[model samples]
Target: MTQTHPSPAADTGPGQWNPRLWGLLLVLAGNMLIDALEVSVAVVALPSIATDLSLPLTDVQWVMTGFAVGFGALLLFGARMVSLLGRRRVYLAALLGFAAASVLSAFAQEPGLLIATRLVKGFCAALTAPTGLAIISTAFPQGRARSRAVSVYTLFGAGGFTAGLLLSGWLTEHTWRLALAFPAPIVLLLFALGLRLIPNENSTTAGTPPTGHRSYDIAGALTFTLALLTLVYGITALPEHGLGHPLAAGPLAAAVLLLGLFTLIERTVSHPLVSLRPLRSGALVRSALGAACLNGSYLGMLFVLTYQMQTVAGWSPLKTALALVPAAAPPAIAALASGRLVARFGAPRLIAAGAACAFTGYLLQLRPSWPLDYPGRLLPTLLLVGAGFVLSFAALNMQATSQLPPAERGAGSGLYQTAVQLAAVVAVALVAALLAGAEHAAGPAAATSAGRPALTLVAVLGGLGLLTALTALARPTTPTPSVPRT
Candidate 1:
């Protein structure tokens, strides 16, 4: 909620550090890193968490799913939350809430309690993540300086997953609780700095909608939330009960109906939660699809690889985590350079090339040839995937928001992130389902056999994403709307 705008006198010259600007950037980037950490940290620790809590793997998967559900479900209204509460208030409150949830998770004795805490943390993230970016937009002067700041900020975000992987690998060695507890202190530190450096809202723009008047669409929010929750529930249950089973079919059917109703509500409402007008933009549609596919395939692929490394390859947690270091870390550098890369090759080209790289990586990783060839097979694939992520992720984000008017940028970002979170949930669930189905087909070799098909599906997703990016590239380009001066 800090509303600090950069002063004209602020020097953001390359190689010259402005103390105030750097401090502000640190605070913002640090918080962004925390959000990113929460995402990847728990993923690596899931096996440990399940063992400690006496839960099945299916149930442990919900710790990650819960976060995705909470994040995706509420993000549709994040802009509304900002408008109603004021940005600084929501940012600070969500930070506090996130810290509290982390603490609760650290102490949780029951699986249900731990999952609930993750949900709270994720909901808090929905509130904080967009606000952090908004703060950066306000705090930094537009043009090259802002671009540099954003690239740095995003680079930190990319690095966070790697940091989390390394940290969780070490922390989970003693107890998974330490990994859960790690963020609380970091959040508190950021909160204290935020209190001092975060600027107060200008009286003119404080506590008011942009166009003088706009109302929150409560009905639309409720319906959309329910629809997403139902959808996730159905998909998550698919592994337990086949798709045709009543438990799975019922929720899936209801989700479709609820989503239909939500769309109708959006169309009818005077001040809709989302502006349906933007939905018609084919560029935005394809960009969002590209993001979903990229995340879905990447995360699902990681899930299977993690299992293969641990259970089949007989590697320790530390060794497994270290093996993935190449995939997790190099993307930070790639993200920083992506802006220039996009300028030369264009976002669509980068996206297509990135997806192709990811697909190739998956193909290389296919089947692993019995005695697990780490150096010959896995290392090269990891590097390829890492390079692909660096290329695609930032470019897709730029493309998604490129066509939006300034006023709707926040909502556009929320929508794009919503696609990411929802896709992650879907990816995990589908992979779970594939693995389960493979068990019946493979019998004695279920553990090893299950991974091949799951990985093949991941490769298919990568190919589909590549095709979508190419389709977008083939279309005529629309001129991006200019941001009007304040």
Candidate 2:
């Protein structure tokens, strides 16, 4: 594919900010905040959901994993939809769908119905999330303005998870259903604003292939989605059922087969869902991997800690949310300054530093003595974790799409977000499995014993992310070859 550059006029610069542009940015970022909020708002309410619905830990976790599966599975397809349908149409439609799904989730009496509604919401999010980023990439100039815009966009995403936690804490006390339904009105408003603000032009720009070259790759999409779903199901079931059981073994085996088939399909497809060429870019891969680790570990930590505080520590929902504020609030404030930081110090360094901070925080929580100290120990850990997000979240978002051509930005965003959602799926599933197994064995003191191994796993994930970021920093930069005048 040919590389395309933004026209000089696209920059508009810092001095040329207009109300319309700001409105557009606000619309995009607000939608992004809602997409992110979906990931965590249900987290604090999970225990309540499980109890009210008479669910086990493994089953109730599907409330979380279901959304991730739907989001990750359809993201590439959503990018294609953006190219075919135009970003404005897709964004508005998805927002409407999200509102409807949120409403369905609120009234769902059966666990199956609830999980299905969550999946629908996730699919809507998959569409809106990448579409929002793609619109930003096309609308903003590729310098300070764009960087700052992306920082603000991502800041809301990081903060949204925190906001969700706080919201869930308050809402879940009365009913978990309110926590599930609250996003409906908010998203409906975004939909109304988006109808006006999102550009009408299709996301496909100069570098896009002709319509003849495009293919839906439906087979690949189905295969890949099923593979992920199966993998998650197997992992979630493994702790309770063990490898010998059909529930665990069947899905695991099928996942492997489906993954192999999906890879084959991607390699053979004309217009592959995800282009293989970009995967070769170390920076892109590093950004995706680093993001996956950061998100996965952070969420996994939250899942484990929520249980610890609520179950073991006997804390109220609101109190637990307040105590955990340090882990989410710092990132929101820090992200405001990240665009300048990325401009000055570069993304790799910040990513490494962030990973290190998160790893240290997780390490602090690894060996929690019974009767865990809140202020001295856990509080510091949350602060460090939040700091890690502050340092890395915006940098990761900026770096992931920085090198991609305009036409490929949507796909690039999809791939990046897919990594994030997949990471959440795996991390939450694994953490849930470990916690469930430990609790089953430990009985009354489940949270105390169960949390240690989960925390250790989170730390390991952080350590690996740190290593990946450090590798990116350590690698020598290669200059692009200059083309001689024809």
Candidate 3:
């Protein structure tokens, strides 16, 4: 197979990092931080929102689910849009849309409207998050420079959740609306800077004209989105309504069929939204799976812990957020050193080690005793989980995109992020279902028991991630064959 090299403008030589490039990276990483912040900011605020809106816990969880669904469902379509519309256009538009959605969320009175705003913001995030990574993948040259850039980019993302928790804790004390509205001005500022910093795709592609003739895969997009929505809906309903119930059974059945149809559509489409070619890469597949497990388990565990601290222990939002700081802070600090760690230990080793640490952390939290020990029990678990992300998150992102060709980087990023978001959706739904079931069976007095199942589920997910990484580590490396001199 003949190889294609990046344009000279795209691939900077060693030690050639310029000021403009650094500025562009910060812009991209800033957007990434905001996107991640959106996911976790509402978490600490959920109890406040539930009380304010007079909604049940299950219903209020939709704020988080709505965003995940919107982000996950449209990611492939967003990738297609990146290829169709220029990255600069899509990115700027998405930023504007994100700011608008955040503003709307602040003023929303009805539950449906608030959820709608979250969904729209999530859709905007779907476009920006992957596009930012694609930009980074292309803007930085391969090897050390790209690896370091990815670390910084992912570092902001890793820290964003922690930042959101702290911010939401303070903001929710004054008003939950502020938690929802806070990203608007920041995103607008990013839009202003992005307009000047982001390069035109045409300019960077060595003068290749945009492909206007290629048809968009509308069928694939619709099927995939519908499938994901239904799947999440079904999972969310499973514990409340048994599988026999129409709400649980119907959507689950439809999701399976829709997924099959989506597969067929991708096989037949001339310009498929997701090309199967990149999916064939083992490194990409492992990265996606590892990322999914990491995100799913971590978010699911957070959902349970938030409720445990607030409802069971009667801890205030700010207090709960402070206690959980161990889980969120270490990743940021550790990510700064991850590029070097990956260079030394390799991504697969880091992935496996990270997963093991997280798995142990989750195991420690399982079947916890009532009085809620922070330093002995929760602190260690949180620290291990944080360390897990510190070791694996950047490695996962780097591995996923580094192996793909430049042309497929956008799709690869979208696919990797889609896995992450969808996994969170499913995991959160599953944990919510389990908690609801435990509550229904034993009532509110059994809250401690309710969390046990959820914690066990999180540990199971971490174990699965560990196994996947170990498999990757166990795979034998194929030696490159040397060419004979003519």
Candidate 4:
């Protein structure tokens, strides 16, 4: 086994534009754009897609969830494909698949087909997403160079989400198809340029091809997928169904059973897709949970504010996204400065401060109204949330990814990305559940009265995120698998 330690600034060698790190940066930024497009572009288009397909809210939700499901499920296999095939082969394959999926999604005649294609695209994205980071991880050593690379990689990924908001609202107004297809051409261009930018190191088999490849655990995969699928679906359905209703109970129970079985199989499997031991590292586990918590607040806040700006306040999509400018831009600024701050203050102190600021920001947003003032209300919360997300995003990735050995990078990264997506899935559903519950209790206009509760939720989640940072503050010198423990 190749003992991989964090060497961010390794000799990336010649033949690959040794001096042209800019090219690699473009490739990475493009990768972020691809992923960001998946989420952000769809938000503004949701109302449109829902209308065109005549799909109910439940069914329409799947359009995005399908992609997330594919993305999360295939992450484990994605890295291995890179390990088995080669970096370039896997990446190009993923890009081509994503492109095809985009075109198909663009031209779909019905919702099911469109969603199916999106799912396929998500799978391709899963394969490609980590490869981009792995390429950087290998290209740069673990010192300042790697640190900068990690910072840039994460910063772009964070900023890309915000950029998606601007582009989504604008593009969907004209044609939703273009929103999907727009990036495909750009990705192809990057694919062509990326061929020379990075070395073709065969990551799959370091030496000779390893024989007797273990068969994938389809049972575990099915059960785990079904479990999460049912649980999330059930939660999302609760707004319509009463809590005691069997409609929610049946699927939720099935999810529990299936997920339980998944654990049992993973423990006994030859090559487990998810390793249980990583959760043993208290530091990593806490950090992973913290990442999830921060996102629960961040994503939920985004959804609420977006809706408030448009549906309640009667702002246009463009105007709604424009309202996000204050919140969106600061993360870019923070992204640039966070690396230095992390170096000086470390992840712990920064995480705490960020969380505190985020808490204060959300509290300020407790009573949002139609006017949606940017300077007084919007700007402060946006600044706080942006700062918190920037700090937490980089720190979480570093804590999760840095603790692993070289061989485990693929699986570890897969787990990390999966958790992030799962966080989004849960945030929307869970936060909405809470909001609806509170709204039901407080009459129709709950967002106005329950701003404090919503803000409180964000603050509490931020506090949990802070706790995760404190746990990881010591930076333990061991492999911490980035997945849930049994």
Candidate 5:
């Protein structure tokens, strides 16, 4: 069967460069970068924040996990909100909310107040991140233009992690408050430009249904929120309270029950928060698995490596950040170059290749040496890991969205982003568990011994992701014929 790809936006010829379209991409990509930047920027500033507020080490970490929990939990609900209120309206409002949260965070005198602000910012981010990608998918024509836009969008997102690390170090050196203050001005500026740039209508993705007047599904919203929040909280808490502890197992069990209830509600309700129909697509299922593995492996690798750099190698924050540049830079470059290649080789093969590279990177890092050599031992791992990101990240995002109709694009984006956040949470937990076990066994030199198990766990994750991507490739291929614009 030849699939006819129909784009929501008016198609300009391939040679024609539209300034307005590019402007929209810039605003959306910038928004994506800001959301991702928040996740990492605070990481380097946590110690400074802890000192200023006199918080315990364990409590201080909630400043980060709180944000991730809120961000991941509200995603599906946010997509439902976008369906009710327009995307343009939700996008701008979310940005405004983010700005306000940033200001509150800057002025917060207590840890409680600061954590509240972080949660608010995370919720707002949940609103904007998926909407930005949906906006791009709807604004660009289906083939080359959409592909390029996704590549650029993914590149900015990948780059933001590195940006946050560098910025946090500099800002925290001056004042940790500066790190908190930075996002307000940037978000407000983007909000202003977005009013002029983002498309006003609902046709932001391929199969988006017309938005007129529909009663909001409040039941669906509540069930979905409770389910996701419980799941995220359970996984994040696992590191603090061992997996056998009630704190870890209780919430996870409740999360499972709530999710089951949510599924039942969705099936029975006339209006659902998430339709399970689109999930039947093999491509989307595999892409979601690929996304899970990609984030899980990459983040887990970073978790163990950070310990290796700081605890074992005695590297300063500045030195660690600089050393990570090789691991971060290649993805951005690869993302830009990958649009054409994605079109030629297709997303599945590239995804498999990327996962394979990441697995190989982890394999190379499994050496249990006492004093790790950076150039001889670590540099090649970083390079391969970066190369793996370059290949898989954009392709995963693109493949997930490529087949969805506009109406379903919001759901698709929400699902993809949720996979990413949940994977990161799970990955960190898994690595933490492995590290804990290693430490218990190794006693005095636990730091040196922990790296091997952590890296091995990451390698296993990468291999699973590679297997998922290969399955996507095994699906029957059909010609994707472009539908001409009116």
Candidate 6:
């Protein structure tokens, strides 16, 4: 069947270069930045949150995990909501909800209460995030404009992470709540602007349903969240209290059981939150797996690098964050360049090459010595890792997004986002567990001596990820006409 592509909407532009187009980009990117900011801002604020609530480091981490699991839970529903409520309405509603949640996070007197507020914040993120990319797809059809819009959209994400680090450092220095409260003001400001700037159209991605009564699968949504929360809580609790401990096994098994049930339910339910079919797309499957390793190693590196710099090399927190600047660059540049790169070199090869560069950087950075090795060992590795990341992230995103049909974009993207988030969460726990155990056995001087093993674990993870990227190399340069999204 020759699937007829939707023509550019009635409002499509050419050389006109309307500010609204740029504004549209901001709306999408801004939504993503909120998610990114929630993570980074809270990092700097952790000490403050802990101190205020008199909680342990383990408990405080939930302030983040709560939000993350929440976001991932509802992310699939995000696409559906856009169809039902209209993208613009959903987007605005998300902003308002996010703003409200931020206030709650800022003012919460109890740790559990803060975690609950974070859950709400996470749901708002899920509602808001998918539409950002979906909006870009419509505002700029998949060509030069999309290439640029994707670049801008992705840049906001990378840039937001960087900004979050910097802002977190500064804001937390004065008041942790300020960091949480900051985006509230920004979101409100953007809310006013978005109201004026966002296109009046509901179908951000063309050719879907033109405003109908889209059903909300409350049962599917609730069950999926329960399963994920159970799993994440279980997995996360393991490092602190070993796998055999009740704190770990109980939740973990329940999560496994619940999630298995969730899968069974998805197969039977209409409008499932996530359909399993996307898992069969060889390109998407590999892309997602490869990206997972990339993210895991990336976060792990950030962890190791921060520890080496601050505890061993005498670098300040600000300086440690600044050191990560290079790792964040390539995605910005490549996202803009993706259209040309894909048009010429093809997506699979580009993904392969990107993974190779990242892998190379990891190998070089893995020194047998320690933090005191400083510029001789650390600087070069950090720079290479940064360079490798810059070259890859955007192209990887373009490749993945390009392979999926438009209607499935939301669910597919939510899956991608979930994978990325899960990788980061898992990396933090597993890497920390390994390093902490190693450090304990090695003693205080281990920081300067045996950190190499931690680095190698990260490198090995990256290498495995690189191998997955090779799968793309075998994929045909052209894709079959996509089915409506997963």
| C-alpha local distance difference test of each model | 0.77, 0.81, 0.83, 0.66, 0.75, 0.68
lDDT by residue for model 4 over 1-486, one digit each (tens)? 853222212345432323546677778667866776687776656656766777644556666676777777666756555666667667877777777788888888798788788778877887777777777766654455655666677667767767877887788778778776777787788777766565556432124223467456767766766676787777766766866788987777878888789889889988777875555545456556767777667766776665556544567677766777666667666776655555555565666666667777777777545466778888778887887776656556656655556765545656667787777666665555555555556853544663445456666766776666665556644432332111
Candidate maximizing lDDT: 3
**Model 2, range 1-486, lDDT digits (tens) per residue?**
933423322435653655556877888899898888887787788878887999878888889989998898888887777677667777898999999989998898898899888888889988887677777776765566776677778778768888988998999889989999998998888777766666555332323423655577889989988998889889988888899999999999999999999999999987778776667666678899999999999989988888888767778788888888889888777756766777677777788899999999999897656676888789989999998988888788778877777776656766788999899999999998888888878874755577777888899999999999889877875322221111
Question: Which residue runs of candidate 2 sit more than 4 Å off their true CA positions?
Answer: 1-23, 137-152, 202-210, 401-413, 477-486
TM-score of each: 0.89, 0.88, 0.89, 0.82, 0.82, 0.83
Q: Assess the local accuracy of residue 19 in candidate 4 as a C-alpha lDDT between 0 and 100.
A: 52
Range of the 10 consecutive residues with the lowest summed lDDT in candidate 5: 477-486
Q: For model 3, how does the per-residue alpha-carbon lDDT over 1-486 read when each residue is reduced to its tens digit?
A: 933323333545674677767878888999999998887798888888988999765677788888998899888887677777778789999999999999999998999899889888889988898788777766666666776677778778878988999999899889999999999998999888887778776546323325756577888888987887788778778778899999999999999999999999999877777766788778888999999999999998888888888877788889988988898898877766766677667788788989999999999998557878888889999999998998898778778877777897767876888899889888888887787778788886776687888888999999999999999888874222221111
Top candidate by TM-score: 1
Candidate 4, superposed: residue stretches over 4 Å from native: 1-25, 54-59, 138-155, 192-199, 202-212, 368-371, 401-413, 432-460, 467-486
Which of candidates 3 and 5 is the stronger one according to lDDT? 3
Candidate 3 similarity to native, TM-score: 0.89
Q: How many pairs in model 5 have backbone atoms within 3 A of each other, for residues 3 or more apart or on separate chains, i.e. clashes?
A: 8
lDDT tens digits, residue span 189-266, model 6: 778877766654533445554455566777777887787767766765754678999988998899888878887878
Greater-TM-score candidate between 2 and 4: 2
* Model 1 segments more than 4 A misplaced: 1-19, 142-145, 203-214, 405-408, 440-445, 477-486
Clashing residue pairs in candidate 1 are 1-87, 1-88
- Candidate rank order under lDDT: 3, 2, 1, 5, 6, 4
Better of 2 and 4 by lDDT: 2
Residue 332 lDDT, candidate 1, scale 0-100: 72
Name the lDDT of candidate 5: 0.75
Tell me the tens digit of each residue's lDDT in model 1 across 1-486: 944543322554543446766777888899889888887787678777866787654567777778887788777676687877677778888889999999999999988789889888888888887777777776666666667677778878888889888888888778889988899998999888777666545522233445565667888877977787677678767767878999999999999999999989989987787765665666677888888988888888777777677655667667777888888888876666766777667788888888888888988967546656788888888888888888888788778878877777666777778888888888877776676556556752555476887888898888889889889878876543332211
